[model samples]
Target: MEKTKVFTLVFKTLFFLLIALFFSWGIWNGYFSMIFTESERFLLLLQQHLLLVVTSSLMAVAVAIPLGIFVTRPRFAKSEWFVLNTANLGQTIPVIAILAIVMTYLGIGFNTAVFALFVFSLLPILRNTVAGLNSVDPAMKDAAKGMGLTPMQTLWRIEMPNAMFTIMAGVRTAIVMNIGTAALASLVGGGGLGDLIFAGINLRDNAYLFSGAVPVTLLALTVDGLLRLSERIFIPKGLQEAAKSA
Candidate 1:
């Protein structure tokens, strides 16, 4: 198991480095510098685009977590399946259509992008939160009750801790998804790195394309790495080992 984990981590690290090197090659090849003379523009674009990703992800987690908790209760379980299925279908809907409709209704810009990204970010967290909470052993709940813990206490002290790993996994997925979807925000004039991409496409400039594409890819990988680090830091080692064995 240790060997497998070491191998996996090495593979992932190498993969990330390879991608970064590829993008760096493009950037070094004068592909990105041809269009943008100001480094600050890239920084500003990163700030704006990353802001959208962070906000949308937070909104999804906020709404999904509570609904997920509510649905896990015995009273809501049966009907909650409907909500879950709805979310599943929401995932299946084309993100482009969702973005387009949102842009039309909201009249363009960041807000439309937020709405679209938020919707796109919902499913993984919602479904995983449900699944994670449900996967907690019932015996743990029973034990908590026998020990005189209230429902809230049982959830806070027992269920949530056990489910943390899965919830984090969902969050990681949402973050990566949000990062990718954010590029589409440029379509409706959200002024993201996508601005570089669309401008490139419009003028037939590879430099503009590389400018947009490289940054977005780096942003996704960076967030993914951070989330993976969070998982390692937060998840209990014993639980991780057991999970690996399972």
Candidate 2:
């Protein structure tokens, strides 16, 4: 098992190295010259994209986790179906359509984009939170109660810790998806990497297309990597081992 783990690690390292080299080659060959030629503009768009993703994702996490917790509670259990379905409705709608509806109300720009993305990001995190909490071993909760721990104590000490892995997984998924979706913000004059991509399409410029496309891809990968690292650092060791075993 240890050898297998090492092999997997080495394989992933080499895979990312190859991808890095490919991007480096493309940059060196001026395949992404627009990124350098309009460095200021590119930077601005990149910043806007990052801001949209971060703000929207944070909003989703802030709302969805607590809402998920609320709906999962015994008192609110009957409402879970309604809540899940409502969130699911957001997912069922096309993102572009959602953006259009949001634009109708919010007009346009960063706020509209953030709201739309937040809606898009809610379901995965909410669903995962509920599922994660539900999956916590009943025995553990019972034990916590048996030890005279209060309901809140059981949740904080026993349930939350165990549920964290799945919760983080949901967060990672939402953030990565948000990174890609934020590109669409440019459509509403919100400004993002999509500006370059769409411009490239209109003008038939590969450089512009690659300039935007590459960065978005890289951002998603980087965020996912960071989140994975955070999971390793933050999640309990026993939980990690249990996950591995499972």
Candidate 3:
């Protein structure tokens, strides 16, 4: 515990120092000269990026969860293999290829970008949901059922609560993946922080690139940390107490 706490403290200190260095560099380069104006644009770009990630990821979760549950159950024996193979195939398809296919059929811009992202984002969430749900203790499930709980109630009240950490872990992975992949949205004329990155690349300007890369990386880390924090919080109180006793 002491070691873990020390590590967490070190990480926090390093993260703050990175932020300080990023701002100081920006200021020295006149990048932060018009602080308010640059800040607004930076935030707007982040908003767009966040929108794309959240929307597409949630859409994926919506589709993935029900299908994950359905396929994992014994009654859907035949469909299980099909769902697994399809998600496997989805993961193998390159983002660029998916974007091209989407653009051809769905036209360009945000809608097409979302569709491509949805496809890219589905596999992890689907696979994790199935894995977490499957890993639930059979004894606990039987106890829930014996208590006269409906299947839905058992899922929501028992299985899901227990699987919270695992599910959040999958969500953290999906979010990080989406943040990186969302940059491809630029290919379809979908404006995002990717514009900053590509603009920098075209201009051979490192500052322009760092302007985007820094924020995106920070966002991913922040979100991932928060999810992990939430996983800690959502762990059953009894479990924490037991751990403390041990």
Candidate 4:
């Protein structure tokens, strides 16, 4: 089992290294010559893309985690459906339509894109958080209480820790979706790798298309990889071993 795990790790590392080398070769050889010649701002665009995904994800986390926790309480339990429905409603609309509608009111800029992305990111995180908490073993809660833990203590120490794996799964889904959606921000003057994609489309340049697509794909994979590491580090050790054995 350990040998298989090591082989899997090596394979993934080598795969990522090969992809990194390929992209580096493309950029170094000026495959995007047309793009750089017009404007030398590839790095700037990549940063903007990261900013969009990170900022919007953070904003969603701020609200979703707390709201999820709140709604699970017996006093606030009745509100869960309403809150979840509201998040689900935001997700029902197509992203393009949401961007177009939001742009009309917000007037097409970085902020508008952020607002649209934030709305797009809410449902998964919120839903998973509620599910994670609710799925916590009832016996564990009773044990915590029997040991003289307060409701808040039981939640923070026991419930939250046990539920963290599920919560992180939600976050991973949100961020991955956010990364893909962020590429569309270019349509609204929100600069990201999408600009290169659209530029390629407009100018009929495959170089520009690849220059944009490659980096965005790498970023998503890299972020997901990092979050996977986080899961290993944060999940209770027993759960991790159970996962491995399973």
* lDDT (tens digit, per residue) of candidate 2 on 1-246: 999999999999999999999889887878788877889999999998988998999999999999989998888999999999999999999888989999999998888899999999999999999999999989988889999998899888888889999999999999999999888888888899999988888898878889999999999999999999999876899989987999
Candidate 3 lDDT for residue 36: 48
Alpha carbon lDDT of each predicted model: 0.87, 0.92, 0.81, 0.91
Best by TM-score: 2
lDDT of candidate model 3 versus the reference: 0.81
Indicate the TM-score of model 3.
0.82
Compared with the true structure, what per-residue lDDT tens digits does model 1 show for residues 1-246? Answer: 999999999999999999789868887888878436867887888888988898889999999888888899887889688989998988998888888888778988888888888999899998888999999999989999999999999888888878888888998998897898888889887768888888889998888888888789878999899888888777778788888999
Candidate 1 accuracy as TM-score: 0.87
Between candidates 2 and 4, the one scoring higher on lDDT is 2
lDDT order of candidates, top first = 2, 4, 1, 3
Report each candidate's C-alpha RMSD, comma-separated, in the order given. 3.2, 2.8, 3.3, 3.7
Better of 3 and 4 by lDDT: 4
Model 4, C-alpha of 245: deviation from truth (Å): 2.9
Candidate 1 deviates by what RMSD? 3.2
Candidate 3 backbone overlaps, count: 0
**Candidate 4 displacement at residue 54 in angstroms:** 0.8
Cα lDDT for residue 127, candidate 2: 96
TM-score of each: 0.87, 0.90, 0.82, 0.85
Question: Compared with the true structure, what per-residue lDDT tens digits does model 3 show for residues 119-142?
Answer: 998888888878888888999999
